[model samples]
Structure formats: structure tokens, C-alpha cells
Target: MDARASAIAVRDESCVGDEFAPDIPGLKARRFWIRNSGCVIAAALLVTLSSTALLEPLSDVAPPTGPEQKKPVVLARTRRQSVTSPKKARLWMPRTGRPETLDLVERMGDGSMSQTSYFDISLDLNENASGSAASSASAVAQVADTGANPFDLVLQDALDARQLMRHSGLGYAADAPKAVRPADQSNVTVTPAQEAMLVRRIVSLPVQPERLRDIKGVIGVSEQDFAQLASGLGGDVVRKGEQLDLIIGQRPAQPNLSEILFARHLAADGRERLLARCDDGHFQLVTDHRPYDRMVAEALAHQAAEARSGSAQAVPKDVAALQDAAADYPKLIEHLARRNVPVKVSLQIVQLLRANGIHWSKTADVPQLDFVFRTAEQGEQELVSVTLKGKGRDRRFYRYVSDSGKPEFFDDAGRSVSKTLMHKPVSAGQLGDGFGWRVHPILRTRKFHNGVDYRAPMGSPIVAAGDGVVVKIDSETGYGKYIRIQHDGGYTTTYAHIEGTPKGLRVGDHVAQGQVIAYVGSTGLSTGPHLYYELRVGDTYKDPTKAEMPAGTTLRGRALEEFRQQIGRVETIASTIRATATSAAHSAVSALTPGSDKQ
Candidate 1:
């Protein structure tokens, strides 16, 4: 049969399907004409037989299903070939303008077409090929004839390209690469208004305990938990690396005396007030309300009137009457003389007072008067010093006033009896709070205490720790009325929570060791009347009880000779006084015993 007749027969067969034929009558007429003509019938039979023989190699492959069958078919020549097995195969399409570039297309099982460069696929296949030249050629011919699916081969090439791009640090994508945001970038959105509101919220938070106590009460937390909360508030949180840290901040400074008074509405106006006065230069006093100046003048005049009467009766009728009337007998007498009391009468009264157990005497003609007194503890058993006026004095001890005018006691050898720094500034005070870290009672937070506390009675005398000049006399919220004294060898001592200093005590004034500087009081953040004493070397604080201090000065030269000379007389008097007191005590004990009278 001719090729034209074979082509015609193939076209007729393709167009003659029962479900796809456009005209049934035309199809029937064509079938009748073909059947009647023997040549046409023979040609049709030959075409069918030849087509079946040509497509016999691809009979094992399933027909293209779904969308793949809809693709346009292109005719290609194939050679008869035999292969034991073909692993994968693909359809190759040549590029329009570039003969070197070929597109290898494969239909996936899911009816998707994947296309890749033919050269790339060929190179990969060459690298992976393990068969001989003849076997490879035979495999290619069989693939072209049978149209075998290349899904696996195309997927493997795609995977290789992706891995290569990744290794080269060029990430692969189906479309264009997009700009990726950094993972560390903050996602939080905060505006200026929001930031300002947050700052205001933090600034307006109440810090005082009175204002915050209600929060704990409402939250129903225990005292310990509340204290923990307060400590947390006082601290700050910081981030370091991948972890967080809590940092505690320094405590705020306490308010001063004036600030405290002003907060409590007790501060007086500093502006001067107008005063009303009579033309005669006397302040006009009113019954409803008296001005401050007028009230002060009246008090002075009343005190003058009383002083006049008291001066007239300077010498009391008896010692008992004088003792009952005068708080300080010697001072009262001196005051009378200063108020123009008769000199003769003042001397007579002084001699009479001296005879009546006063023991007051003058040092030759000097104005300095000395007094002798016995302590209730030792009574007359201890020989009271004629020079020392107060308690805590021993007859065996010799007092030496330094060139600096600071008095210190010494033994016969002239070694100082006092320490360089006193461990306790208040003699009668008991140890209370100690130095170091502790949970604050009022603040409910952990804090470091820079000083030690001494508990003593209110108004009890507070003395200097050593011979030093007063540096600061000021009031603070925490320290109240406090005094700082600068001593030798970089040593400084602070006396705090004091009621007041002596009338003449001021900053820059020299205070001697054991000199009464101030009185104990609960003038600061104190639980009771006590003295807060601090010891410092330069700017660093130290525990007063444990700190090693400099050695006390030793008397030498003329001072040493004078101290030794006085020690001998003081020792003799002390021995005589002790012996007499022992004898008297023995007599009293014997009189009290039941069989003593008979003995």
C-alpha cells in the first residue's frame, strides 16, 4: 500500500470513534464505501496491522490519563531497539533560537510537567551511569521508542540543583528571592505617648510605707512576703547575655531637720512680722493675744523680779534650807555675787557652806573653784579627788592637762589610762544595734548599717570618744541632732541621735576625751532613746569595738615629772581613806551581829 492511502486510513480510524463522531450518516457512508472497494478494505487492514507492530514496544505503558492526554503530540522517528531494563527516561525538546540549549520535560505521576536544562541532566546522568557504552545506547533507544516516564530522574536533578545552591550559600526559591527580616529585630510597638505614660506611671508610684502598706493589706500577703516585695521594688532587673540579673540600688538620702519640720507643717515663716509698740518704746501687749517679742520681755522682767528677791536672801538661815532651795548651790552663790550681793556676806556664807559638808574651796585667789564629792557606790571608802568634780575619778590617778587643753589621766609611770578611742561614747549606755548588713525595721528591706547603736536613758551625757575638734553640728532625718569630730591619725567619730549639745558647744570647738558633748535622745529613726556612734578611717567605716586604734600619748619631760609628783600624794591619801573606811565597815558589821556585843 502507498503511504498516502496509509495516512488516509489512519486519519479515518482516529475520527471514527462512536462517542466522538460528528455525523453518524456520513460515518456510515464512508464505512460502506470502504467495505465495497477491495483495495480500500485491504489498505485499511494493512495500516491497522503495521500500526500495531510499530506500537507493540509501548504496549506495557499505560495510556496518558487526566490532563496529560490533552497535550499536543509531536511526531518523531524511533529505531527498533532492545534493553534489559531502563531505570528512568525523559522527553527532550529543543530551544527555539538556541540549538545548544535543550529542555528535558517529564510528566509526573500527579500530571505535572517539570522542565530542566538538557545539558545539566546529561552531565548528571553521565556522572551516575554505571553501564557499558552498548548498554547505555540500547537504554536510550528503548526509552525514546516506549516514551517511558522520567519523573524520578527529573526530581533527582531538581533536588541536586537545590542542594548545590544551598552549599554555595545561594538559597533556592520557585520565584524571586525575597528580603528576610532578622530574627533579633524587636516586634514590640511602642509610641512616644505610650512611653511617656509608662514613665509617668513609674514616677508617680508611692514609695513611703504609709502609702504602700495598704497594697500589702489588700493583697493579703504575710509580713515576710511584703518585705520581699519591698526589696524587689528597691532593686533593678538587668539582662546579661541570655540570662537576667537583679541589681540593688543605693538607698535614698534621708531628709534633714528643716525638711522634716516643713513636711509636718511645723516650720515657722522666715519673713519678719510687723511689731506694734507704744510711743514710749514699750511693746503693746494685748490680753487676747501677746506678740512673741512682748511675751519675751515680760518673761525677762519676771525673772529679774525673782532674781532680786533671791539675791537679798543669798545666805540661807540653815544648810538644809539652802540645799532644799538651790539646785546647784555653788552656782547659786556665784550668781548672787554677780548680781551685786555683799562681798562680806558672800564669803561668810561660802565658809559656812564649806563647813557644812560642802567641801567647796578656792585655788588660792583664782576664780576657779574646786568641789569634792563622794560617789554613792564607794561612799567615803574612795578618796575623792580635790581636782576632779564628777564621778568615775580615782585618787590613785593623776590628771594631766595637755598643751592642747585636753585633760587625760595618767598612772605613776605617766602611761595614759584612757584609750586612744573610747569603745563606748556614752558611759552608761548598753550595746544595742551592731554594724553590718541587716533587714531594716522601718523600710522592710535589707540594708547595711554604717554605725553601732548604744541604748541609754534620755538626756544621759554623751562624751567625746577622743580628744578631737568638732567638725559638724547638724541635724538629719536619719541622724537627727548629730556631731562629727575629727581626730588624729585619720580617725573620725560620729555621735548621732542626740538630744542637744552643751550650750557653748559648736563646730570647730575642741572637745577633750570624756568631755560631755551631747545628750542621748530618740531624735532620728530610732526605736527608743539611744546614741548612734560611728567610727571611720578616712571615708571607710569600721566597727568601733573591733577596730585597732592608735596608742594613747605618754607623758614625758616636765609633764611626766609633775604627774609622778602628784601620784605619790594621791596614793597616800587613797590608802588612808581606804583604811579608815574598812575599820568603820567592820564596826558596823559587828554591831549588827547577835554575839558581837558580848565579844
Candidate 2:
């Protein structure tokens, strides 16, 4: 400090060198230095504090730098408040379960119009347990708050909520599902019964069999769940009141009393549900569970098993699988025709047809099973019919037998053999005694009897042997009651032991081969109710089996022409198998029932 002060005094001319001195002295210099030191220290502190305060605020307000930033998370849309409708909407049921969406532009309470999306839902009222809704493009579709009560509950009507839910123990008010959501929306609940009904409805195909061939898959159930619905399969099923009830499973609170009306559609669910009764229901919607058609086939298979038990006569010894359209249909049908189905299941079979001179008979494999019905309407005609199990579209139908006589094989010199023989004279037949020298049961003597005795039940029908005119109608003690008919060529035939004369016939009446002649009975010298049939040529008796009569049935003139046309129609139907769709499965058996209207 002393050197710096001496140098500063020498340089400054105002100082006047070191020999001169100031009048104020050292006190003024000390006072100036104290003030300068205070100003410098205060300035430094002010600069540090100001910088720190500015920096603290900048650090908080500034955008984050580097890798710390992240994208924001989106949240679920809040459900809207419920709205009450002013009046009831139209109530109607939808025929099909096709999905639909509605965009509604509604006016709010404050007069502002708002657009909303409404999804259709279906719920089972009998169920009280929780389930899910059918899905859509987003979760919002599932969670949208319903705008109205959804049901036009006219509680003032005789139908209370409990009555509306059917007789289910679940009262409509407390247990039945409503469109209104709870404050905390939990999963919808369903009962086992509701679920079973749902599955049954989905599996039920339309009345047409062709439509059933390709069934749509079930939506809400699993394979195992759908299978368990066949409760009657494992247990006995009985018709209780109006319903087919199962021995297993809990009985409904009240027996379900309903009928199938063609006018209104009813299903395993309620009798008939209208959209006006309730808007939409929520199910824990399941989708694409399993093969629907296969399950139906399985159900049908099970039904067949039940049928087999009751109808020992109708079911074939060899339970033939349904052969695709082929000779097999005729063969299977022939087999089925021989037996009778139980009345309950008879309608399930689609058809019954008769294969007459076409050679179902005289063939070893194909049984001669002719189920005929007598009609009093048309002079007592007989109709023998069989069924066709029209399989797939394939043309290779199966054969009942291998050695049947075809026209090509029977042709001689490009012309077929002589016309075929007439049908058996008696309704029930098989040669009990041949036309040879044998011990006659009544006479007990060996002699030639030129006729065959057809074994038959009492009061059995006897048809004319061929197209012929009545030659004689005689009642003798030896022949009991007999009718002789003169046929084409010099051939003639006689029916003996007839209980009564054929109805609506006289001496001059020309008769067809299948015309009813008489009823079988033990009228005279006979062992039991049997038809003693004898064939003759030019007044000389011959073996009935060896005798040949007219063919193509015993029709004549206009009647013969009509028969030919009917056969042609039958042949056309036989050829075009699967392509034909008929609603006559029920119609086929309806005629057999007592109260059924004639088909």
C-alpha cells in the first residue's frame, strides 16, 4: 500500500509531488475507502441472489428436456345418464336374429339435439345370474348406457312383471333383467334353464328338411354346454300335460302349457317375444361355439335310437345308414315298408311307395313287404308304398339286390318276354299247399288238387286275379262262396271260401286285377280262414303258380291309362332324389291318424 500510494502521488501533477501535503489529512481518505468497500460487497451479494431467484423459477416453468417425456394415457368414456320415454313404443317380435345398429339424434332436456349410437341386445328374463353382452368394434359399444327403460311396462294391465316373465320363480320386478344399469355395472347373470332354452332356440332348424341340412352355428354356448342340453337323451322322457318333461332336471314352477301354432312362431324360449314387450336383452354373448349341423345330426341319431326301441317292427334288422341317392333308397324303403313305425314317430319318415311289377318281389335280398291300404272311395283299390332316403346330390343310388331282372337281360330278339303274372289273389299269401298229388287234409287221400290255398287272416281281402268279366258267382258247399272271372286269352280264375261277396259289383261288372272280390273266411270245407285259388285254361285246371295272367296291373281303357301316368310320375320322382324338397313328411302320416284331416 505505501509504494502504490508514493507511485500514484509522483505520477499525478495534482498531487505536487511527495513534498506537498493535503489539508484534510488521513480521515477523509479512510472515510472514502469504507464507503467504497460497503458498495462493492453489497453489489456482489445482490448479483448472486438475483441470479439464484431467476434460475429457481426458470427450472420449474421450463419444458422437460431429454428422455423423460411420455405419451398420455386415454381413459374410458363415461356412461350417460338414463332417459325416460314419454310413451310406449310399438311392440313387435323380429322374425330373425340378425344384428342391427341404430344412430339416434335425440333432443336433450335443454333443447339441444345429441346424436347417440344404440346397439341391439337380447336378454333372458328367467335368468338372475350375470352374463356378458355381444361384442362390437369397441368396448364403448358394450358399455353404452341405454337411453330408456327399454320395456314398455304397462303395469296397469292384467299382466304383472311376474306374469310377463312366464311362471319362472324369478319375479319380473326384482329378478328379471331390465335395461337400466346399476351405479356399478357388473356382469349380467343367467340361470341354467335360460341358457338351455337359448341353446335349443339356436339349434332348432326350420320345418323344411333341406334348410336343416346346413344349420347355422350356436352363438352363446360352448360345445360341452350345448351337449348337456340334451337332458332327455340320458333319462326317460314323458309327455306331461302339454310338455315333454324329463325325469331329471328340476320341474318348472308351473307346467309350461303352450301349443305350436303355425300362425305364430314359438320356440324353446318364451311362447312369442315381441320387441315392444322389451327392447333388447343382454346375454353373456358367446360366438362360434361348435358345429351346429353336426349337433343336430347327433340329436337326430339319438332320436333314431329312441325310435328303434318302440318300433321293433319298423326298424330293419340291418340299421342301414342313409345311403346317398341310389338304388339304396328303394332298398332301404322296401325294408322299412315291410315293418310299421310307432304312431308317434311315423310322421318322421318322408315317404312310402310301392314297387310292384318293377321286381321288388321274386328277388332274394329284397323282401316282399307290401303294406297296402284299402280305400272305399274308389271301388276298393289297394295302394302299396315305400320310402326313399334321398341322400346327397350323387346319382349313384344303392341297390337292394344284385340279381333283379332288368328289361335288357329279359329281352329276347330285342323284345321283352311275355307280359308279367298277376299279383297274389289273397291279401296275405305264401303257398301253403302246392298243386300236386298230395294228401288232402280234409279228404285224407292222395289226389291231384289243381289249385293253391293262400294262408290268410280272417276277413282278409281277395282281389281279382286279372282284368276280366264276371263269368259266374256261385255259393256251393264244397267251394263255400266263390266268384269266377274270365280273363284275357282263354285264362280264368276262381276264389273260394269267400266270407261275403265283394261290395258294389254285379254279374256284368268288368273288374280289374286289384279289385276287391271278397273277404277271406272258413266258409266251407277248409281248415282255417284261407283263400282257395284255382287257375284254369280253356276250362281245364292248371297249377296257379305255373299260370300266366295279364301284366301292368289289371287296369283297362281309361283306368289303365291313368295307372300308366301315375307310374311315370313315380319313376320321375325316384330319379330326381335330393333336388326335391317336400313339406310332406308330416303329411305322409297324417292320414293314418283318427282325427287328422285327410291329406
**Where does candidate 2 have its weakest 10-residue lDDT segment?**
394-403
Model 1 local distance difference test score: 0.44
Q: What tens-digit string does per-residue lDDT give for candidate 1 at 1-599?
A: 58798568646755465565555575556765655685777889999989978997876554565666645555455432322334434322211111111111222235433322211111111122332333333443333344332211111222232332222222223322343356523343333321100000000111111222433332222444334433433422211111110111111231111100000000123222222233442223223211221222222222223223433222234323333323324343433222232323234334333322243233221222221112121111111123322334422234456555555554446655434577888988999879999887667789998989889999999988876788999999989889998875467899998999999888889777788999999887887899999999987999987775642446668877766755553443334223322332233233233443344
Please provide the root mean square deviation of candidate 2 (C-alpha atoms, Å): 24.4
Instruction: Tell me the spans in candidate 1 whose CA falls farther than 4 Å from its real position.
Output: 1-401, 404-418, 551-599
Cα lDDT of model 2 by residue, 462-504, tens digit:
8886656888888998789888888755677888988887667
Query: How do the predictions measure up, each by TM-score?
Result: 0.26, 0.27
The local distance difference test score of each candidate is 0.44, 0.38
Task: Find the candidate with the highest lDDT and give its number.
Answer: 1
Best by TM-score: 2
Worst 10 residues of 1 by lDDT: 195-204
